[model samples]
Target: MIDVYLFSGFLGSGKTTLLKHMIGQVKAQGLKPAVFMNELGQTNFDSDSVDDGVPLKELLDGCICCSGSEKSEAQIQTLLAEETFDVLMIETTGAAHPVEALDAIFSPLFAERLNFKGIITVADSKRWLSRDELSPQIRSLFLEQIRHADLILANKMDLLTEGEQAKTIFELQSLNPAAQIIQTVHSKVPFKQLEKTTAKKSDDVVKAPVAKLNLDTRVLRFEAGVKRERFEEWLRTLPDTVYRIKGYVPLEGDKYPHAFQYAYGMAQWLPEYMKMQPQIVVIGEGLEGVELP
Candidate 1:
């Protein structure tokens, strides 16, 4: 089984920035973990922030509410089947309902391989008060995000004054009586703090039973040695339908294992999990065959 951590926060609430900071400890600990991100556009910084040592995976371009959640779950399963990872951290889009992630993780296909660690939310100390006062939708979402969190990161503490900080902390405590409210600036915390399991005393554990999302799907998994020249040709010939590709292969005489991936349209390569299995996943429009190696 793998440890799964779900992180939720409002847009611009510093989830990405804080996640980046936490990943620094992940690198320092020498604990290589795989990160999955589901977002609106194609841009993500989770993978780029690390020291090119920690392997990161992304599922972007579509929100989890769309076909991306299924695709993301499938990719995670295939990865676990190939190489065992120490942990998996997932960051949902700001607009995504936390229950949707809970449903996806607890589903039949994924439940067997992973277990829930905890849910975390990053709240902006300065803007949250006004957000709650002005926009009811934002307030509801914020409360929902915090209510489910095992940890509430009072991020952006640098922006709040001394008095505002105390009031913000008190308000968060009132809103989420169960979560451990911690003051943090820029997601600064030790790896143990984020990974440690917390006790649950409250009954409201975010069980938003949701209908299973049905998906018409397909898969292809295979291994074929490419002549050095054929390697570049194969890479260039990749169809646009290929949503993601990940695995370890010798790009040049086995000097270094080349682990790479393509999400949406952007792709990157990093040497990792050299001794593990060779695997990759491509998801997109009109998929049908399940080719196996």
Candidate 2:
């Protein structure tokens, strides 16, 4: 049976980073790996991070737990039929509820053909600390993600103080006493650690409701290079409802576009060596009227 790993996390929680690392490690072990990525936006930006020659499937513009659940099963079926990989990794949309995602993937059509490893959740240290600021629904979803994880990756530890790290681990442990928690920076964890994780068998636990969160996404395409200072100024004007922003932006005086990411009021820019489309995907609540640079 093929091994399958499910990745669950909130927006900007570093699931993709960990996914990339696992792909590399699986390849190094002389085994082939495949990926099925779910995105909340119409355009897929994170898909580009997967390495060349790896089998990949994308489910876009919806979460796997609700409207896209049937589509995801079809995509997985197609991947299995065409790919010669030994391991398959499914990365759910950041906003996906863990129980619903598992329900969608545990379809009887293909359940017996695979070994369900576990759900590896990447919990942003800073986000966990300030989860109270989020809406009641979002906070509940976030907690549920942790509550169902088989292995909880306490990511972004570098951004936290020592005390904050302890608090984050303690809170996560309190939420899911059965799962193992690992502190990590950039979502880095040994592949062997992940290989040993097995899903907790629980037929009695209640599953989360089958509904998507009320999140909005807006795509901003830039026709001209934007000044870095002007873009930073625009970011400062954003309201707290804006949860995550990621994509490429062509900056004035730069030969190539820079990859930009913003989460929980923090912004980061990384220069890219190759040219990419200058577009940004903004995910948040009530983003239809938000202005952009």
Candidate 3:
């Protein structure tokens, strides 16, 4: 049986950063690790950040928590047969709920061959402390992500003051007294602590929170290469309602396609070699019919 680790957190909570560190640690320990990533939008950007050594299976277009809308049984089966990794790490969309993600991951067909390792959640210290600043849906989603976690990495500690840090701990512990809470900077938590074998097996003890996201997605495809300046400008000027923008773009001056990732007003561009069409997927609230230049 392969050990499966589930990573869940709110949007832009630093799941990718933590996963990259954990992947390296797992390799140093002489264990082969594979990653299964689920992105909320159709276009992907974080996949480029994953190391080339690790085998990755990406589930796109929807959250895995929703049963019919986002199924992973076929993908899981494919991974189990084709990949040789002893450990499989699943990184769900930052907005995913633990309960639903867990259900989708341990589909009835593959449960016997898979061991339920545990759920690791990364919480942004600044975001958690400023709940009043978020929308009702986001605030509820963030709280639910932590409630069922086996380990909670309260990340971005560097941005918090001593007093704010203390309160962040108090708030997380209040919601998930059972989870091991660790303070981390840039989502860095020791991998040894993450390798803990304790797994939660009850789906009945506590009720999982239900969240309905009223978000929309748009995919912009470009047949020709785009100017880096214009692409960066669009990313920097995205409306506040936009949550994430990702995909690959063939830059006018670059030898390879450039992967674009934008969230929380931050834009990141990296060279991508993957043989995929140049397209961008924008996900956000009130984004229907929003034109992109």
RMSD of each: 11.8, 1.4, 3.0
Off by over 4 Å in 2: 208-212
Which of 1 and 3 is the better model by TM-score?
3
lDDT of 2: 0.89
Clashes of 3: 1
Kindly provide the TM-score of model 2 when superposed on the true structure, using C-alpha atoms: 0.96
lDDT of candidate 3 over 78-178, digit per residue (tens): 88888788888889987677777777666777788888778899987887877776778877887888888899999988988999999999989999888
Worst 10 residues of 2 by lDDT: 204-213
Candidate 2 lDDT tens digits, 56-77 = 9999998898889999999998
lDDT of 1 by residue, 1-293 (tens): 77788889765566766677766666577766767776654544344454565556667666664467787777666666666667777888765667656656666876877867888888867666566352444456666777778888998788778998999999889988878888988677666877775634335564543333221223233354435466545656655444344444455445445665543334456765435444444443334543432
**Which pairs clash (backbone N, Cα, C closer than 3 Å) in model 2?**
none
Q: How high is each candidate's TM-score?
A: 0.65, 0.96, 0.84
Candidate 3 regions off by >4 Å? 68-70, 203-205, 221-237, 248-258, 269-279
Ranking by lDDT: 2, 3, 1
Lowest-scoring 10 consecutive residues by lDDT in candidate 3? Answer: 65-74
lDDT of 3 at 18: 85
